[model samples]
Target: MPGPPRSRVSCAKCGEGVNDRREVISVLEKKLCRPCAAGGYYEPI
Candidate 1:
């Protein structure tokens, strides 16, 4: 059987269009792409 449906969402940092099934990371309630998410751009303001 197939998994859940994938939703289209843009990366909160880079604004890249990606599917939910992709390797995305959520930080502070925001969805980010792998590159941006791993880039350590989440610096406290």
Candidate 2:
């Protein structure tokens, strides 16, 4: 079965695609991805 419909959004800083399933952060009235919201990318383990 297919998953839920995607509601794609763009991050204010990087313009990365964000979907409804992923976590979205709002800052200063702009939508941001997790990395952007966290102020940087995560280091790989």
RMSD of every candidate to native, in Å, equals 7.3, 3.9
Model 2 segments more than 4 A misplaced:
1-4, 21-23, 40-45
Residue by residue across 1-45, what tens digits does model 1's lDDT show? 267546777888879877655746675878887778777656659
Q: Work out the TM-score per prediction.
A: 0.55, 0.60
Model 2 clashes, total count: 0
Instruction: Give me the overall lDDT of model 1.
Output: 0.72
Q: After superposition, how far is residue 10 of candidate 1 from its true place, in Å?
A: 0.2
lDDT of 2 by residue, 1-45 (tens): 278656878888889988874656575677888888876655659
Inter-residue clash pairs, candidate 2 = none
Q: Which candidate ranks first by lDDT, i.e. highest?
A: 2
lDDT of each: 0.72, 0.74
Quote model 1's TM-score: 0.55
Where does the lowest 10-residue lDDT sum fall in candidate 1? Answer: 18-27
